[model samples]
Target: MKNVLILGANGQIARIVAKRLLSEQADVQLTLYLRKSHRVDDLVAINSARVRTVDADIHDQEALDKAVQGQDIVFISNVDHDPDNELTQGVITAMIKNDVKRVIASNVLGIYGEVPGEYGRWNTEMLTQAGLNRARRSDELLEKSGLDYTTLRLPWLNDRDEVKYSITHKGESYVGVSGSRQSMADVVVKMIADPTYLNRESIGLADPDTQGLTRPVY
Candidate 1:
């Protein structure tokens, strides 16, 4: 049974990933880490022996240390506003101290300006430029952390339930405009179950059928 720790358990993607893990891997153990305990009351209400919730700030050394201990994989999903990459560093430090070696993290596309055409231009111009740069630095830290890691660069996210997606490597340009959160969650589970493409590579994910400047044709 694999032990999994989700750092940002309250977010939509993390919540979906947790459910998928529970449904797909019955023997797996889950540790959901969140800042607010009440945010995941529904998860706790499940009352399964395999599910555990930890309430702590991801940057708190003692708390993070306790969370990562005895975990086989650490999934980082920081939705909080971190412009300095501090949260990413904290996760790495805790993982190192706990001897946990595998990580799968969510990042934004165009960190390297790999998304081509007008779509790339629109995303770069209208989105959080500062946040993109900060995420790039965070990605750099993960690359040099000496631990097995996979960074997923995501496009504009929607809450659709579709699971279709396409992948592109670090240097390769992005394929489509929008990707569903469900597809991203599915990819995270895939990385956890099989680390065949691990080791600090950045992957861009998009729904193959969706193409436009923004989502919902607006």
Candidate 2:
């Protein structure tokens, strides 16, 4: 069985991805790591044999290392809010220690100033310069970490159940200002199922139809 460790497992997108994996990928086992293990009691109850929970802060290096051990992939659904990017760095350290090479991380759009026009200005205003810089630093650290990684730069997210999204590469301007959380979860599930997909790439995701909106779709 392929073991997948999901950090920030209680997050909305991560929860969706976990449920999808449980239903669609019978060959996969999950290690759900979150600060509050009780938040995932339902998942563990669903399949205790295939699902495990780790309740510890990501900064707990020993716990993080233990969780990463023997996992085929690590999915980070949380953003590092630390100004020093300590959270991302900690995950990288743990993955390296455990020799886990595959990772998929979530980030926000406008990190590279890739959004354009009025929407871009609005996004910048929303995130503020400091927030954008922190995200950029996280992506930069991932690029230099030498792990097989895919950084997903997501736009404003909504609860829409539909899974429709378009992708743009690193240097390309971001398309659309918002997308569904389901779309983001779908992309993560795809990458988990196929390790070679989008390896070592940082890409943007959004619903193409949401493009050019001065405000977020939420």
Candidate 3:
């Protein structure tokens, strides 16, 4: 069984990914890292045996290191305001110490504020600025650390009354260029299955009438 560690166990999407992985694959072990020890409603479908939760903050190096031990893949889905967000830095170190090779980090667009379009309008101006800035800083720090990383930049996310949607990589411009919008579930599926996206690249996502990798190629 491949052991996978997910940071931010209570995140909207991480729960989805855990089930998809266990359901889709036969042999898998899931460890969820969280600051608090709490059971989430989203994890109901999954068996308590396959899923284990740990109370550890990534900023705490020793606790994080213990949580990351013996895991093959680490998914970082934490977004909180910590001084320099040692969480991102902790991932890099944990991977090195544990000999884990694959890492998927969640980083959104406009961290540099270089790309802006449709998505920007949806966000309250200042709120968008601070959010993207943190994502950008997280990405920058992770990339320089020599860790194999995949950074997914998601657009406006919606779970209300929507059928399905499409995702675009780093390609064409859309009405919502501010960033992409993808379902927490859908995004998790793509990341785990697609190894081509394994190292050091940012993906922009969206929810549309069409679904999966739909921006007409980069």
Candidate 4:
């Protein structure tokens, strides 16, 4: 069975990923790591044999290490908020220590100033330089950390039920200013199911129909 560890399990996208994995992938086991374990208690109770929950801060080295052990893939479902990139660095350290090589992390777009046109300007104004810098540093850490990684640079998100989306590589201009949370979760599930799908690549995600909008659909 493929073992998957999902950090920040309480996040909206993370929760969707968890449910999809449980329902769709019979051969996978999961360790849901989050600050408040109770947030995923329903999953644990329903899928007791395949699901385990860890309740601890991401900065807690001991708990983090315990969660990382014996997992085949680590899914970082939350964005890095620490200016120093300590959270991302901590995850990298734990994964290296445990010899787990594959990771899929969530990040924001425009980190490389890749968004285009009026949307780009509006996105920049919305996210600000400081936030983008922190996200950029996190992605840089993963790229250099020697672990197999795929970073999803997401656009403004919505709760739309549809799964329509597209991908663009790191240097390509980010397209479609807004995408659904379901679309992002779908990408995560795809990566988890097939490890080599987007190996070592940082890609941007968006809904094709949402392109050219001056602002997010939401």
lDDT of 1 by residue, 25-76 (tens): 7767999998887888787666468888899888887999999999998888
Output the lDDT of residue 140, model 3: 73
RMSD per model, one decimal: 1.9, 0.7, 5.1, 0.8
Model 4, 1-218: lDDT tens digits are 99999999989999999999999999999999998799889888768999988889988998999999999999998899798998899999999999999999999999999998898888778888899999999999999999999999999999988999999998998879899999999999999999999999999999989888888997
* TM-score, per-candidate, Cα-based: 0.92, 0.98, 0.78, 0.98
Every candidate's lDDT: 0.82, 0.94, 0.64, 0.93
lDDT of 2: 0.94
Reference-based TM-score, model 3? 0.78
Backbone clash total for model 4 is 0
Lowest lDDT block of 10, candidate 2: 79-88
Error of 1 at 215 (Å): 5.6
Model 2 Cα lDDT, one tens digit per residue, 1-218: 99999999999999999999999999999999998799999988888899999999988988999999999999999987788998899999998988999999999999998999999998899999899999999999999999999999999999997999999999999999899999999999999999999999999999999988999897
State which candidate, 3 or 4, has the greater lDDT: 4
Per candidate, the number of residue pairs that clash is 0, 0, 8, 0
Summing lDDT over every window of 10 consecutive residues in candidate 3, give the lowest-scoring window. Answer: 209-218
The list of candidate 2 runs beyond 4 A from truth reads: none
